[model samples]
Target: MAASKKTLEQRGFHIEVLNLINPLESMSYNLLQLIKDAYKQGDTATAQTLCNTLSYSLYYNPNVKDPFWNNSAMSLCNALILAVIDKCIEEKTEDKICMYTVANMLSELGSKEIVIDKQGNTKNVLDIYFEILPADSVAKMQYATSNFAKGGTTRGGIFSTTMSKLSIFTFEGIAKMTSRNSINLKRIGFGKSIQGKGTPRVRVQIIFPDGSKESIKTDTEGRFELNFKQKVKKGQRIHVMESETKKKMIVEVQTINKDTGETTYKVVEKQDGLQIENIVIFEKPIAVFMIVPDYDSSNHVIASIFIRQLYFVLSKYAGLARGGKCHREVVFLLDEFGNMPPIDDMGNIVTVCLGRNIRFNLIVQALPQLKMKYGDASTTIQDNCGNQIYIQSGNKETAKEISEKLGNQTINSLSRSGKGLSIDKSKTEGIDTKPLLTPTELMRFQEGESAVIRFMKRRDNKFEKIEPFPILNRGKTVMKYRWEYLGDDFDTDQSILDIDIRSLHEYVNPRDLIIDFFPKQEEESFEQPEESNVFVSEPKPVPIPSEEDPEEPQFADIDEDIEIPEEAYASEPVSVYESEPASPFEPLTLENWKHKTAEEFFETHRSIWNIIEKQCMRQWNKSLADIQASTMETFIDELKILVTTGEIDKNIYRLINGKYGEVMDSLLEKEGVKEEV
Candidate 1:
């Protein structure tokens, strides 16, 4: 009984054990009483039978059944189902249930069960489900745990606010350090006061390098500080102009420390890369920090916050570099990347950071996780990566995608046919295409094995070319690192003091810095007005020549030698050079052709009218009126001469009449020649 009680306690069945003990106690007392009665009645057989029945009942009590105590598949299934139900109840909420919520709950339960049985008779329920779920689904569940769905602004609000404050503080420190020609003050105070009070507000204007201006006012203490939300880069000048009249004076610095027996005198110099008094280091350096959560941690909300803060800091550094080459390369190796909140503008960074020597090595369990978080943008993100290494994947989809990307190769296929009785045989060869690596082969790769697709930019024939290469190799083996176990040392001091806070506030003067950029008044220049002499010239009228003047030759006199054949002007115009009389055709005149409603007029006159219009316009440099005023006799003479010389075929009229009669009429009308027939 004691052993059974201990086992029940070990298996976390304390409640069941208590219920069993309470019932068994009463049963035991009743059994003793019954045995005594049987003995008194001289019935030994009844007492023995009663004892056996009670013993069997105690051993096989259904109420005290423990799944952990049983070592069988059936017990394991029951335990898993009950565990899931318990988790569901514990995490019940008004919001719609998500797959990730269930997955996380199941994972936690599995962990506890594993602790209870180091060598379980069945596989873990969480592991089984993980393998079954698609990669993207798993990724989304992991992303939800980081609380990124709350929106980027909300998730990163705290970090952004804190960084803004720090940047303002740092800017003030830099101003103080760089103010070489400023007056030193023994003490300075900045305080805000109620409006309409005794203290007066002073307006100050700040002009950024980009020509954007911001106006601010001093507090009751005549001191002011500017807080900027956007990131500020190095060498970005800020011009401060005081609205009120203020005199500028150079300040000197002198320090004496009686306690340290030291005396110092120095002048601040104009320079860049000013350090933030104590917290931040201005020099470039490599840094690494680990972000780990406890095994049973509910979510990675805190870790995600830290990561977001780090991203902002890196972004500031990148901004300082001004999108140019970075002084040093910065690389972020994010392990279990899907488990963190999505970083803002991560896609932009991935696409452009490589040129600035900034790189991100994101490690994920599967590609689906990435796709879940990025959605359609997942493809763009993957495409921008210069190199991709795909290790063995249990996911058929992932393997297939990778295999297809590896490309296809042609192979020889052979086929043979034979009939034994006829002794006839046939053979054929064909070409077939298949992927470089089959999906099955890709998935079957052993541990430490990977297929790498590297896009290398190399100069070929003086031109840069990007080519991809597939490489298969085993990854380097690494030994596990461990530290010796040690008990807590209460006496040891682990505190670190890296910077002195006293020096930060020693020489700050917001008032003097504000006055440094005061607008200076320039003397206005007044020159004597130049003497003005008015000169007006009399207007002269130019003579206009009349069209009928003898100096202007008539169209007939311009080319009078050309002659037109009588047949060309006959009622039915005929080609003069043709042996047979030309077929009757339509006129090509501007007015008659414009009114001609026939498709043939357009087809036949289109080319000829184009030529005539171009020639008239070029010869006279005149408008459409000049083309109308020209004599039709001159055109008819030119057409006859062209036909006689065979330059314009007479058969052209016959063909135009048969195929496009109205076109021929439009052409003749456009040339100012009347089509009588």
Candidate 2:
């Protein structure tokens, strides 16, 4: 019997242990099951609550062996709690939640609360933490205790704020004594404030050694991880600009101290380039002149009068030098350009110059003497007689000689009027037809028009007239046209006009087209019309009152029978006889009242009787004239009753005295309180 009792006691003790451990475990199992159901069904808050209960239960579990159990359970619970919290956060983004505490809990947890898709087979929560820092004791401890609350530390770095179109400019200088280069440029993520979608473009400009500038533009997302693209040196300046009309910003370059690791950055101030005006630059000087003759001078007469007369026709080309690629300061010219100095002693050339880019050339209409005196090879072929133009020439030999020199032939005799025969470049057949000139040669050319010329073909030594392309001696090129420069004869330059050469690619933000929803407009157009018949329908109508009532007393019996005349009763109310109540010439004054209280006033003017009774005025007064003017016998009697019943107080007397001063005067005269004032 003793042996059997001992065995029974041992069995009961085992059962007691099982019971003690099972409830906590069972409760946790039930809570987890409930949470799993909530999580699967999308009941996030319920899931979070069940998780919290499980965590608390785990904390209290006496038989629990894992020291990390509370943290692990709390992490799972917190994740669900935070996920429920995250929804609220996403909705209320500005709300603050303990991210660090949550992170700590997750780090302590050995497993993650998040589920992974089976097919993709992503790393679970614990896997993520382990992958980042497998040997990190603190992190491992956090995960073990808080269930993966630590998360992947690699991804956890900085906090973001709500600022749209965020742009960051990093300024750093490597001060450590080493050969390593450290300065880099980059754009971080959008600020937390950047809510919508758009292609944000960031521009970076770097000013390096020798005052040279380099610029690069970033793609969408405002993210640019900078590595060394070029050599870095000392005294370099870097600038980054965020170019959005709504969020225009400039970020300055900064450097961090090596020892302290302290960094500083300043907001950059940008100047508007377009607003700057009248940019001017000094250029070298060149000569400009029109070849006109001293026609009447006999001593200076040339062999051909027509030759001298044609000088002006070719003088128009003088301005061509001013429009060339070389910069021109000024164009100085007489009849000849060869007379000018080659170079001034100060290292400045003695030729005309414009901006650094303008083209410069010299033009000269010289006689043999002038050519022999100052002409050089650098004077340009066109400056010589190569571009010489010929008009009417009386000498056939001179004309033939000129035509031969120009690679043209004499067609006919010059003996006839309006007809001259010579050979020159034929613009039509790309050959030197060497055609003779008529009145057209003497006419001035318009701006849009140009003269065509067939130059003598030098290739193959062929005597052919080649029609060169009609060059606008004053126009510009394609590149110069990109930037608009609006002034002078610059219109002729192709370089000055923005001609379409290629299709344009523009980066545009998508949110510009989105419609904002706040403060939405209400639609009032679809209101329901009221149904008149539904409310108007009556069930039945009463029959007309019997004609008998002769026995009933007439309403007239109650009325005062002392009517003076029908005309008197029919008369318009005395208010009609009076002009519309005159506007107060001045503010109302109590000095106008003769009566002590308002009751006397209503007794006089019954038109104001309702007002007196409505105001509960016990003692009222009115001017004598006003009392005589209205029917007030009933009003006075009613007011007297109110006073006798003790309804009138000193306050009422004061109110009457102050508010109805004009009416009180008549009442006072009737009462003989005092002479009307």
Assess each prediction's global lDDT (C-alpha) against the native: 0.37, 0.28
Off by over 4 Å in 2: 1-338, 343-357, 361-363, 367-370, 373-380, 383-402, 410-466, 469-677
- Candidate 2 residues 1-677, lDDT tens each? 11222333343311011011111111000112233334545556555554443333222222346534334444444443334233323334212122222322233332323223324333444344333333532223323433333444422311011000011100010001000111100000100011111224655443433445444344464433222223322233333333443333333325543222233444454444211111111111212112222442211111111121122112212222223322212222233333332211101122222222322234333333223432342333333222344433344443444344434344533322332475443333232345333223323333332332334223334756555432222343212332354333233333212221111111111111111111111211111112211111111111111245222212222226432232211212221112446532221222322222333333333433343343432133433344334333333332223333334442333233222333433333434445311
RMSD of 1: 41.9
Residue-wise C-alpha lDDT for candidate 1, range 400-422, written one tens digit per residue: 88898788889999998888776
Consecutive 10-residue window with the lowest summed lDDT within model 2: 162-171
RMSD of each: 41.9, 43.2
**Highest lDDT against the true fold, candidate:** 1
Stretches of candidate 1 exceeding 4 Å from the true structure: 1-265, 268-284, 320-326, 420-423, 456-466, 474-677
Number of the predicted model whose TM-score against the real structure is largest: 1
